[model samples]
Target: MTGRRVAALAAAFVSVAASAGLAIVAPAAAAPGCEVDYAVPSQWQNGFTAAVSVTNLGERVDGWRLTWTWPSGQQVTQAWNATVTSSGAEATASNAGYNAVIEPNAKVSFGFNGSWSGTNTAPRSFALNGVTCTGEPGPSPTTTTTTTTTTTTTGNPVPGDAMAQVEAMQPGWNLGNTLDSTGSDETSWSNPRVTEALLDNVKAQGFKSIRIPITWGQHQGSDHVIEAAYLNRVKEVVGWALADGFQVMINIHHDSWQWISAMPSNRTGVLTRYNAIWTQLATAFRDSPGRLVFESVNEPQFTGSSGDAQNAQLLHELNASFRDIVRRSGGNNASRLLVLPTLHTSSEQARLDELATSIRGFNDPNLVATFHYYGYWPFSVNVAGGTRYDATAQKDLTDSFDRVYNTFVARGVPVVLGEYGLLGFDRHTGTIEQGEKLKFFEHLGYYARTKKITTMLWDNGQHLGRTSFQWSDPELAAQIRSSWSTRSGTASTDQVFSARSGAVSAKTITLNTNGTTFSGLRQGTTELVRGSDYTVSGDQLTLTAPAMTRLSGSRAYGTNAVLTAHFSAGVPWRINLVTHDTPVLASATGTTSSFSIPTTFRGDLLATMEAKYADGSNAGPHNWTSFKEFDRAFAPNYTTGATTLTPEFFAEVNDNARVTLTFHYWSGATVTYHVTRSGSSVSGSP
Candidate 1:
């Protein structure tokens, strides 16, 4: 149902679509030998990244070609690690030079970026080597449901400026995994039926707003008519929030599956349903308090990778339709504040710009921009089983919030962190950690308050008990309240100082505070140790020797030989930086061989190694080959025969990373090498 609590990765499902206007042309079935899993890793306005993995369940073929049809007009832009060709709705992807061979029971992957017009739909079927691949088909067409509900327009109206209303909702909570449950029953997913007492408990804990993410599409028919039972149930729950003096936000939760985000072909259908849904909702709540806010959609994203321009246009149209439709519904809806989501509801600078640009020129004083932030992945959500939050993690989190503030809040646009919370899963007990989740809540609460951004904590019976109407851990709940309470007085008055470096030998940096006195001088969240890390003289800050050690990774260095990297598949790696004046190695082609490192300036010049590889496509996990940096005087030259050389400074090194390199020979012998790196040593055995 697109509930924030439900992990989308584990429940990844394929969505297949047949040509809307074409005859039912069944593909020819070849001998059962392989299976394929096709996926859309990402999508934007008019483009998307498509990936497919093929497993040789039978005898291996020297080469393979995977084919699929595009229901709407789509064109391939570029492909990596594979050769892709498209003709109308049909397209084929074959392996590149080094990935042509496959052994029995082995799997290979390929992917491409494609553009689309009108509507975008996933291929209904896929074929490998002219045979239909066996695997799960796409989501089937949902049945349309129709129901009629008695009209009721009743409730007191809220008063205040839209921004003031938003500010009033300082700390919020999401009634997640309850009414938004995808199961047949509300309690099927293990959360008890939401009760008034639960709302009371939430309010008692200092939460001022409750966001209800309801899946209207699931309860609607093909014609987009929402069943009366479902609509009334949502209204009842929202009523509870409003009655408890809580700000309420209701949105079209899981509308992507309904093709609401698809444009052109399904544009008409999508708009029709979207407008109808809001019209009905606005009419029902015509007399309700202004606290009952309407959200356009949750994570309103195009199905495939769509270009930003296309996504921006689609989002614009959808948001305009929402604002226009709801306003025309009369009653308190005429001036009710609305929430608009950015692309992917992401905190990315580019996506935020897209949203700001799309909604520019239109004067909507009663609107609040919203985006979701769970910036520290693997630790925020712990998807990859990581359990540490280091200095870098904290810096990233701060930087993300800083961007949002500068982009939206600073410019007079009120924003809300619609949904944010780290997963509570504990690695030790294999159960949700009520206590551990508090630390994250504490941090988020502090960040949100300082940024002056309204925040809604996502809960799905994980942190609080629904049946008992009590917190699973009262101390955890108390910690959240305490964090929020800190914002009761003055906000943090620390000013950020950038260590601008132009020359490699520059040691003194100036603070741009314009004579304003400030402390807590940090370089990207790493607070400088005054006497040891750096020394300040007036408005100038000078770096100490420890700063260089921290940057060069010298203190952590050891006598290790070569740093070898093995990729899951052949991927390009570019070393050295190039500018308009001085063009160095702009590109390099050795994926397995060692290279000569070059000197780089800290800020003015950067010798970077950027590897581009599609996650889970044409390659397995490339642990070490992600990104690396070397020091200014660092240079490493390793000989394949027996040579050794000099000790170089490494700014950062993912020393021990597992990489699987696949090699396909013209002689039909496929060889696989497993590479391991420790410190600077590179060793691999096939």
Candidate 2:
């Protein structure tokens, strides 16, 4: 998927070359022998995703411009590649930015995804490389039309470059996940199965970004590690979204509290385990492209206020460690944009700075800070804001947005409004008064640009009542659609990217397996990319991609392995991988190698691996077994480490089909095995 693409809009230019005082005749057509073939999904033929493919019949083209007309009453709703234009019944095409040089025999394609209301016939007339298409003439060749009908669609995502486009192209939506499970649609993450329809609804309403807050309660019981099944479940959801062309964010959501709260005195041990978890997590997804992003941790909370700088210092301690974790992980994540949290995830409160400020100095070039807009937590809910004070009390709460965040704006720091909305659920609603909330949207957008910040809707897929301005609220949806749009024809450098981890430059990984050394580009957790630039290899993957204002990378699974990657920039870069599994063997950087199965590691276990940056502020334990649905042949990382059998932890195979097997490991320890049966348990192993 490279080379010239079609421009969304069409233009016409006639030349008049005359050395003498005489008008010179111009060619009737700009493109001479171009041809086009178009086919879109039945659901797309009319809506936003109008499929248009162009071919070169005569010369190869460096770029292309595709323009056509749908019958009399049809037109393009939105366009990309080239600008689109429409007249009464005619359509035309022209160059976009630079000239579309058509070689003697090559062609290219370009198009945009848009939504439409009523069904419209596909345009039959088209132009390519430098010629007209074979289809019957559609409308006149001059006047073009535009559609008013609205259709919502997800961006198309491919491995390499498409992910960046997806993030930039995606509309905003709220992350349904949080640290502590709220347990219901009103507060916490909804189950994935139940959330599918909600996602489709999101796309229908035209949203592109979704932040999935995850809690790594994987190993809640032991080894101070995360679990595999939990990570597997998260991966399942991420895969679905990426396959749907989505820009997703998977961060250490609730575990921030779990890791930070009820602190233990063994700080060094905590740091060691914490660092280990990140190392393992980073290695697992070493092959992921760029469609995915890694949000280091959710809001870093503190019980104390300005008086307790010590607690703040505790938060700051993670700054250097977190950076080392990411830079060492290798691949695009090296320089990928990593998101950090502030004191309590508050722009105003966090404004005091601590880890929020230190994170700014990471070796990685693409890093951003994250904050939430709870504004007046309990007050907004009406429960805390207090029942009186009329207008004055509300103003007190409102000043934070304008007064507090303004500080960060002054510092030129990039931030994302992680959580913010008028919570009018079964609980309360007072973040804003009335229509005034809409102003929040507009102001936020304008302010972000001025402040150079990014904002995400607290959430948009919640089942909270639609009557109020919530996830399901139609009014809220309308506000987002109206206020946030890239219709101005001008583009911004800051894009909501799917890849937020980092980048790699001439990356090479040396593996030590059976005393054999292997080297190549290290794979990154990034979920999207431009296919022409990178590829995956062996269990340890490597890649190098361009780092621009708009492209970044992140991890899919929470913790995996460590990688040593060299980039054109940054010295002694360090990344993090967090996992419960023990690394048996790997490279010096810890990116590639094998893991020694724990004596307790056994069963038809499912393992999920994820990567995180070393900013190691918040992380959790993870087991290397849980992801079962993935076809292992295609993606081996999903395979479980090992399985064991223990009476208390084992399951039955069947009643009559009992089979027995003996323990063969060198040592005797409790083994947890996976068993599926319709009836009874077998006396021994299957």
Instruction: Indicate which candidate wins on TM-score.
Output: 1
Tens digits of per-residue lDDT, candidate 2, 457-507, equal 665345332233245545445545644542111011101112123332333
lDDT of each: 0.56, 0.40
- Scored by lDDT, the top model is 1
**TM-score per model over all chains:** 0.51, 0.41
Cα-based lDDT at residue 220, candidate 2: 43
Each candidate structure's count of clashing pairs: 20, 143
**Listing every candidate in turn, what is its Cα RMSD in Å to the true structure after a full C-alpha superposition?**
21.2, 28.3
Off by over 4 Å in 1: 1-160, 382-386, 424-439, 487-686
| Model 1: lowest-lDDT 10 consecutive positions | 147-156
